[model samples]
Target: MDLLPRKGITDDEIGGQVARIIELATLEEKIAMMSGHGFFEQIRESGGRLSAHPYRAGGGCERLTVPALYFTDGPRGVARGNSTCFPCTMARGAAFDVDLERRIGEVMGIEARAQGCNFSGAVCVNLLRHPAWGRAQETYGEDPWHLGEMGAALATGIQAHNVVATVKHFALNSIENARFKIDVRIDPRTLREVYLPHFKRILDAGCASVMSAYNKMNGEYCGQNRELLTDILRGEWGFDGFVHSDWVLGVYRAYAAAAGLDVENPEPIHFGAELLAAVKSGAIEPQVIDTACRRILTTLYRFASAEDPLDNYSIDLVASPAHRAIAHEAALKSAVMLKNHGALPFDKIEVRLVAVAGRLAIIANTGDNGSSRVWPPYVVTALDGLKDYLGDAKVVFAGDEGDSDAAAETAKAADAAVVVVGYTARDEGEFIPGDMSGDVRVEVPQKSIGGDRDNLGLSPDQIALIKTIAAANPRTVVIVIAGSPVLMNEWIDDVPAVMQTFYAGMEGGRALAKLLFGEVSPSGKLPFTVPASASDLPFFDRDAESIEYGPYHGYTLLEKSGIRPAFAFGYGQSYARFGYRALKARRSRAGIVVSVSVINLGEVAADEIVQIYVGFPGRMVDRPKKLLRGFKRVSLIPGETATLRFEVPLDSLRWYDASAKSWRLEPGTHTIYAGSSSRDDDLLRREITL
Candidate 1:
């Protein structure tokens, strides 16, 4: 019997089938569909790894021909063995190319299906409230508008292959150290305006699943928060898909079923026998269990019954050459050039001996070693890529800062030098030993993986290395590998050129080589603001049990406080020069349409990200100075000009009124700024009345 997906099935018919299956299933069988199975055996087989393959979490019944939900984790790629590792989500966020993000999502979906996964927890849209958050690499960026656009694109691409795309961490899951116990205190207005908008945007884009966070919001665990899961998600937003817990300790009690949680992931510690007993003892109603099962079956059947876009699910498609090319493209587009004093785009003929310094240059430093880690077939390092790119020109390498003198001498003898430095998994990532709340039986062995970063700047040794290399060779380029923004005030002035390559994936080295050799121009922009000092940002305590989330962060906070950042939110330099002119804005039927003409004045072809920001110069209520409304990526050759237009929705300009408990559009004249970055000097402004 063929079990492939069928073509052209209606939603009503799928719902009827789900209802029939729920009615036919026994009480025990129905209970079995609420959580993961084979918890202990999976751990044993993988030797305690987070996710070795696609684990069947819940939902399947042979008696009713119901299919199980096979789950895989990622925002980079399929979190399984030998998968194509693309740039991290934060790195891709820097690209600001929705089309590129969608293409990457399609590749991820194809790979997930080939690995036998029906559900993908790959669309992580959690807001980056603070860069110190360990898992910052998993999210898109700080701006709600930007996050929503990038995440929605990925979700749309993934669902095209008939896989259920999950938008994750429900709400306010930024802090990573005390994630399981922290009670995030956020007001309704701040919650709606800042954090929850992105999640709502992804759901509106037709995403099929959600993963509840481990943290608490207003003193209630997100896995069991009725206000968040039921009232808002179901009643207000009308989301019909299922929601599962994060991982082993995601759900603490069986009564979470009534609280709106549908499935417990990677195990059934709380939702298995305890839930059965709760139902039998009248502690939990049968209706709750039935509702959860119905939702699960409906989503599973809907995806399983749809026709897959691909003809075959070959294992060879896991890390195919085509997918790797996308990864390489993402790496190339995501690299942000922070500074350059005419010391970049090294000429291969002029530079014969190139010296590569630092320890990270030789290692395959893709990303954190946590759950999102992808085991690509191979990873190219900087040394290997530079050596390959410059065949005749000799490339020399130097190890860590322990031998700073020797490294500096090597740089002094070479024509140019490239020093790679930055944080590793030990410095920051997803905290592994999560709080084993309630009565979980599995013993989670301690792994040296992740925690919130205490210091935002690089180590003393790295700072010294940068200064030393710069002193020895006037032409030295510094490459930083990190998940989030690193404070570089200490040694930034000493280096002639610097680039932030945030955990570039398997093809990162090749992209880096291309960028350095002028094969491609650097076009990626900074997704988050880089502050001159940590105090310029919001107050953060990674280990705090309780914290208050405010209405401002990133560039908004900087502008509101009248402080200057070392680099603006959307700031990045390209080898090719770009000039903006002819700024125009007009009211359309949808809302407002803003257009600007951009011309490439340099000698090479390149891409430029056109940013549109909306500012309320005069307003009744307190608000950020300006918020990012829309962005578009355009490509142009030397001396060529392109006119780009962005449609700003009327709804995007509304502000949440705490007293009315609804969104309000303040009537006033608004200013629209268009430019290459968020800096004031880079933008051209126009005024419009609503």
Candidate 2:
């Protein structure tokens, strides 16, 4: 019998079907449905490679006609081999284009489905509490509102293909090295206001599943934390989807199922037979198993029964030319130009020779070599792209960082010099042991694998290299490739032009070539603030056993401390100049509608991101100086003006009232600022009272 739901089947009908299937399932079958086959077994079968295809994790029972969830990891692209790798999540966040993010999500879902996967752990929305977090690239920005919108768009697009999208690392999962043992101490108000709004936003957007983090909140692991898994996620937010553990060590107790964890992924040492024993001995109720099975089966059947967007899923669709083009588009839009002194958009005809320096320029550095890594068929390096673009022009390249004098000599000879530098996978990524065993213990040394960054600034050698290259060549452009903010105070003033291209995917090199040669303009913005000093931000201890999380970080922290960032959040420049005027605000039925007229004053056509920041002036309660409430990306030609309006929802303006255990909207005069960046000088303000 086909378990796929027929067309037009209501959710209630699916629920009923799921209930019947659970009722028919035996105790053994129910327990079997709650865990994965085995991560090691799958790896062994796949010639010792992790996730050779999609990993099968529970719920396939022929007797019940319930389909199993084949899981694939992502946020960049499919984790499987030869899949298209788009720019990292941080890069996409810089673009601030929801439409582009949604398109990338659609490609991810299609590629995943074509590779025989139904569940995608691709929607990683963890807040970037600190740039030092090793896995910062997997998330969007530091703000909860921006994270929510971008994650929602991605989840929506993925689900459009009938593939289950899982928003992951549930709460307070920023740290990397000590994630397994770190206890994040956060007050109720701070938790609700700062870290969780983004997760709630995605849940409300109809995401089908959630992956609990490896870290602990308050005093308990997130997988088994009752307050997190049940009280907040399900009890308060009304999330109906199933929850899975992060990986092998994500769950510690067999009774995690009772705490609302539906599945233990990639081999459940704790939840498989151990959970069955707990149920039989009355340590845990059998009803918990039934509930988990019902949720998983319902979601699985619903997607399985839905009609696919394409007629057939072919392997050729994995990295199709069309999808690659979308990746290219993302790379183009995500490049953020931090500084330019009339040295950009290199004249292809006038410039006879170009110098490319640094090791990153020659290597295909996509992103962290962790779970989010996508093995595209080929990658275009900065060297390759320049050679391709400057067909007749001599493109001299050097990757030796130790020999800066030689590199500088090469730079001195060239008309323009491009120095590519930043952290690699060995420097930062998901912290995991290089070798694996059956017991989930680290058998081999892990000194060179993923871990949190110890320093926020570039290596001393990189700084010296930049200084040398800049001193030698008057026209120097430094392209920084990193997952998060890099302290550029060391050498930022010395360079004429700089751009942050955070792990731009396989097409990154080509996109870089286009932007450098005037084929496309840089339109991306800084998602996180670049503090002048590391001490100006929040206190971060990668090895801390216990840490307190406050409501402030990123631009909020910088604003609160009255510290000026080297580059403010939402700051970026374009070849075309944009003028903002006629700023206006009015009360709407929802909350408030803010409109601003923006015109491209420069001769070239370009895109501009109009940001809306809401400030609580003279408020009784403490709040950030301003919060990013709404934003829209607009494109304009020379002398063309467009009026853009953003609807600020009432819910967005509400502040969590810890006293009443509810959200309260303050009724008073609130200032609305419209600008390109978060800096006061970049914005024009208007006050509106509610």
Best by lDDT: 2
List candidate 1 stretches off by more than 4 Å.
1-7, 434-440, 443-445
Task: List, residue by residue over 1-690, the lDDT tens digit for candidate 2.
Answer: 555457668778988888787878898888888888757766656665556868887687777677789999998998986899999999999999999988999999999998999899899989998999999999998999999999999999999998999999988999998888899999999999899999999999999899999899999999999999999998999998899998778898987999999998878688877898999999999889998998888888888878888998789999999999999999999999999998998997777899999989989899888789889999999989989888735798854488999999989999999999998997889887656343564333334478899988888888888999999998899999999999998899999999999999999999999999888899999999988988887889989999999989999998998889999999999999999999999998998988999999998889999999999854768989999998899999999999998899988888888889898888898999999999999999999998
lDDT (Cα atoms) of all candidates against the true structure: 0.89, 0.89
Kindly report the root-mean-square deviation of model 2 from the true structure over all alpha carbons.
1.6
Residue 623 lDDT, candidate 1, scale 0-100 = 82
Q: How close is candidate 2 to the true structure, as a TM-score?
A: 0.98
Clash count per candidate: 0, 0
Worst 10 residues of 2 by lDDT: 438-447
TM-score of each: 0.97, 0.98
lDDT of 1 by residue, 1-690 (tens): 222224667888777777877788888889889987775667667867756857887898766666798888898899877899999999999999999999988988898888888788899988988889999999988999999999999999988888889999998999998998999999988999899988899999999888999999999999999989999899878999999998866778888899999999877788878899999999999999999998888888788888877898788998999999999999999999999999899998888888999989999988777878888999989898888888635888955678877899989999999999998888888888743324555455644569899999999998888899889999999999999899999999998999999989999988999999899999999999998999998989999999999999999999989999999989999989999999999988778999999999999999999999999744578889889999999999999999998899999889988898788888888999999899999999999988
